[model samples]
Target chain A: MEIEDENNFKLRPMKCELNYLSRSDGSAILAQGETVVLVSVNGPLDIKSTSQSIEKATLEVLFCTKGGKPSVADRFKENIIRQTCETAILGCLYPRTGISLTIQELEDFGGLLTCTVNCACLALLNSGIAMRHMVAAVCCAVSEEGNLVLEPSYTQVQSASALLYFVFDSRERNLVTGFTEGSFSENTYEEALARCRLASDVVFDFYRDIVKQYSDVI
Target chain B: MKISIGDVVLPGDYCEEISQVAEKSKVIIGPGLRKEVDRVYITKPGVLKKRNPGTFWVDSYQKRYVPSRGENVIGVVVQKAGDIFRVEIGGSITAALSYLSFEGATKKNRPEVQVGDVVYAKMLVASKDMEPELVCVDSHGKKGRLGVLSDGFVFKCSLNLIRKILNPNCPLLETLKNEWPFEVAAGMNGRIWIKANSMRETIAVGNAILGAEYLNDEEIRSMCNNIAAILAGHVS
Candidate 1:
């Protein structure tokens, strides 16, 4: 179940499109390798009186699967996305309002959570919502032979011994969110974090390139 | 790709022209453009447009409507609470339309506004913190074209499409109006109320408006003709 590639540290080819949905305030379709996710953002809209926060906008994330009802795993992914995006968005600017992020899983080959996070960020940017800075997410896995693999596919994920996801902000490349599964040494964790942090540069650069492509039309 | 004015821009992308102009004089940065300490950055993915003397804004395709003052909008009366009617204008919150805002209305005689009726009104006070207020009468206390509309089909479209057809340069409405007699009221809230003599004509008008979203002026004219021909059974 091991995938031996010459460039194990490199990410898969990425594609991003903004304003994919006309109804949502902001929308984007993002793909990482075989994984695809559609994210839509609606907000600074009215919040329910009971759930409204007086100081800042309330962030709500809903994750939908390709079919059937959402499971507990989907809810977990929604929480991670909400927490990561909460820091990136300037919610305090729109008080007592609510910002809703909806993620639709198009295809899941692997790295679904990371792809979802990236798609949400792009959709947020497309919505013209004010934010302190942009965020990017990268996922990495450790093979049975202790080799680091970046952007692994579904088969590779099943064989991997340890998996880690890291989210970094554009301003300082600081760690905004991090999640890991499986047991690993502290040294391995730090090494994986550093590797994913470096790999995150590619995602951020992709974001710039996508924006630049559209900016040329102006 | 090289970026320039009128090109689509994204967040974190800055404009040198804006910064250079800001150094000499004050420049008004509108929506989608933000002024930082060092430079002016775009905060949305849309075409950057500039007016003659320094006003710059990004024209992006958006669906959600944000209430702004002095814009005519079509809203549905959702509630009849005391003197003020709560109207849903597709904003974050409902707008308040007072009974006194209508023409020829007094404390003794209330305006005949019922729930679920579509009204074309102008936004008087649209602020972020305060609820937006709507008026059906102008300063001259005349109803003019602002009042409850009856016997029409209302549909929703993107805010961008609404602006597109409302643009003075757009040929969609002009071409369609010549082909058939139809009345239309476009709201800044992305809602349109159109009335024609027949259902088929109503559907034709709606299709023409929706189809013209991504088409050019020439295409829109052709599309309107195609729709008209189809409605008249001229097209095989």
Candidate 2:
């Protein structure tokens, strides 16, 4: 299960564009390989008395698939995204309000959940929403040969033995959320976590570059 | 990129100049600039703008409309509840427009307003705790360009674009006004109501305004001329 070669792990080509939608407060379209996700955020808006919390803003996440209705799996994805984003956002700053995030899946090659999380984070940043710290997620798969593959494509995903998604916060690189799909040995899981955490640096650097590119426009 | 004035700033970034000015006198920090115990920090991702001596604010390209007092907004009449009309100004909550807020209206006579109509009104009271209030008449009881808009096309754009086109220095309106006869009412809420002699002209005006959002002053002028020439059948 020990693959010491660094070349074994590589992320797919990533692209992101902010403010993709005119109606949403903040929006972004993110693509990794063939997987594309569009995310829009609207909030710090008025909340109904029943849903409004006096102490913090209410967070809602919705996931929509391509030309299909949302299913139970989509609901689970939305729940994971909402919980991860809630930890990053400074919800207390917008008390008695609501922050709604809607994610639309345009394409799903592989690692769809990871791409969704990353896209949502960028959309949140574009919205100018206050946050305690930024979050970045990376997905890794363990192939049949025990090779760790970062951001495996659709075909690779089908052949992989196990898959893991890890989300890290910017403050201390702490784990915000982690999801696993298949069983793996303890040593293999630890190795995959370490590799994915290292690969997350690439995502974080990508975020900074995107922000800096837009910051120059003004 | 430049890290100076007119550059995009993010939350938690501090400005030494603002902090220094705060020491000399009481400075009014507008939206996007927050004053903590130590320094002045930016709370939005946009260009930092300064006016004259002490007024500072961020010129961010935002789509959401946050209601503020004394600002004119174009809203739709969504609900006609008994005495108050709930107007959707793209804010968190619908604003209340009382029928009596219209000019020459009394208990016996109610303003002829219906749902789905667009109204150009002024925000009388916009607070965080309560719903906003709108009025179609001025203090002198005059409907001075503030009333229900009729037979015009309404569309929404980014809030910053509305402000950009409305700015006196902007050449978009100046150049377009000469090409054709058109009337435009731009609301601070990112909604614009435009009307022209023909539907083609109206669409042309709309396209020009929307296209001018990303262009500079010189580019905007040229774009206006291009649009005008096309509308005049100079280009196919």
Candidate 3:
């Protein structure tokens, strides 16, 4: 089957560049709307004996803000990203090794979590680390007008009543992560979940495009 | 998605062709493709490739090396234990190189191997839970093209580039073979050791290999031609 392009996508346009770093094993810079993130993946490299796991490779994730010292919120984001990626990476393939993922936030207009998760997934793909499946993250906001805005901008998020971020794996489209802020009705939450799930397909298509472009060039 | 050969596949995509062949005969599934209970799944983002009767794998670009048994690799000896040497092959851990595994080495006789010396050896035992072991001699006790590589420069590159130059279809090695009198050893771990009459010829070989990393077949041919011409004093 022919791979579908993202022209039919209603979410904000995405731009990405893969394998840009000279030192990192794999790196990618992804910009979703105004939110830009740079991510790099290295390993299964030699692991320290202290942190080695006999059953599987240890995953270490570091989240960096644009500048200054990391705050509690950054640590929280790191946990979320680490959990989401750990689920996807087949860490058992390289037992006693460590896979390190470093993410630097460049621009955070809105939907920071969604953009970060998506960019992290792209970096993992570029690293060629075996993963059970790929993941796509979508952000939606419930505006004061009682309408859901997909991939809300800074101003859109400020005026919105609630914001939701959902990460879905490619296989089965299962929800791997979900984060929300403010209050919304149960019915509205379900509606946002469905819409985010559909929007995730656009991100997956974007990933396919990036991989296909690089593979063809090589 | 029902993936066919040559299709750009993603992790978790299904390939029915392999399952159909499995019912009749055995198939070799390489890296990037995993066999589940009932079907075949791609675990990488790249083109699904097939060879011969039934060998399928996804050719994804990667840098990190995972030691696999029977693959020849170049490593640097890091530590010297009583009976074995710890060689760092860019894997998860240092591989053990037993002294007795060398050619013509007995308990009383030891090969003059030193720390930080580069060697081309074959992986004898590479298991997930066990330490990887390297051997300098073949089963026949011959050290043919697999031993201490001295007086040569070594450089690291992506695993994909190593595979590219080593492939029979790739013109990289074929083009360089005619350029100059040089000896080269490429390890699957992405280290390449090269030696020639002088530094100029050695650098030329290294240049040709590194330059071919991103170039297509046509471009690589011209690049090799240019390097060869420059080295022969035909062009300055």
Which candidate number has the best DockQ?
3
Pitting candidate 1 against candidate 3, the one with the higher DockQ is: 3
What is residue B174's positional error in candidate 1, in angstroms? Answer: 1.8
Model 2 Cα shift for residue A180 (angstroms): 5.5
Give the number of the best model, judged by lDDT.
Answer: 3
Model 2 residue A171 distance off true place after TM-score fit, in angstroms:
5.2
lDDT of 2 by residue, A50-107 (tens): 9998787899998999977869999899899999999878787676789999999999
Give per-residue lDDT, candidate 2, residue A154.
97
The digit string of per-residue lDDT tens for model 3 on B155-233 reads: 9998998999999999988988887788999999989999999999988999899989999999999999999889889
The superposed Cα distance between candidate 1 and the true structure at residue B165, in angstroms, equals 0.7
* lDDT (C-alpha) at residue A93 in model 2: 65
Candidates sorted on DockQ, descending: 3, 1, 2
TM-scores for the candidates: 0.87, 0.80, 0.97
- Report every candidate's CA lDDT: 0.85, 0.86, 0.90
CA lDDT, candidate 2, residue A217: 49
lDDT of 1 by residue, B1-236 (tens): 22468766655567888877777888888877777787777666678889867889988756777788999999999999989999999888999999999999999989999999999999999877788999999999999999999989999988888988999999999888888899999999999999999999998999899888778889888888899899889886
DockQ, cand. 2:
0.27
Q: Which ten residues in a row have the lowest lDDT in candidate 3 chain B?
A: B172-181
RMSD of each: 3.6, 4.2, 3.3
Regions of candidate 1 where Cα sits further than 4 Å from its true position: A1-9, A15-29, A65-73, A126-128, A182-198, A205-218, B1-4, B36-38
Error of 1 at B91 (Å): 1.4
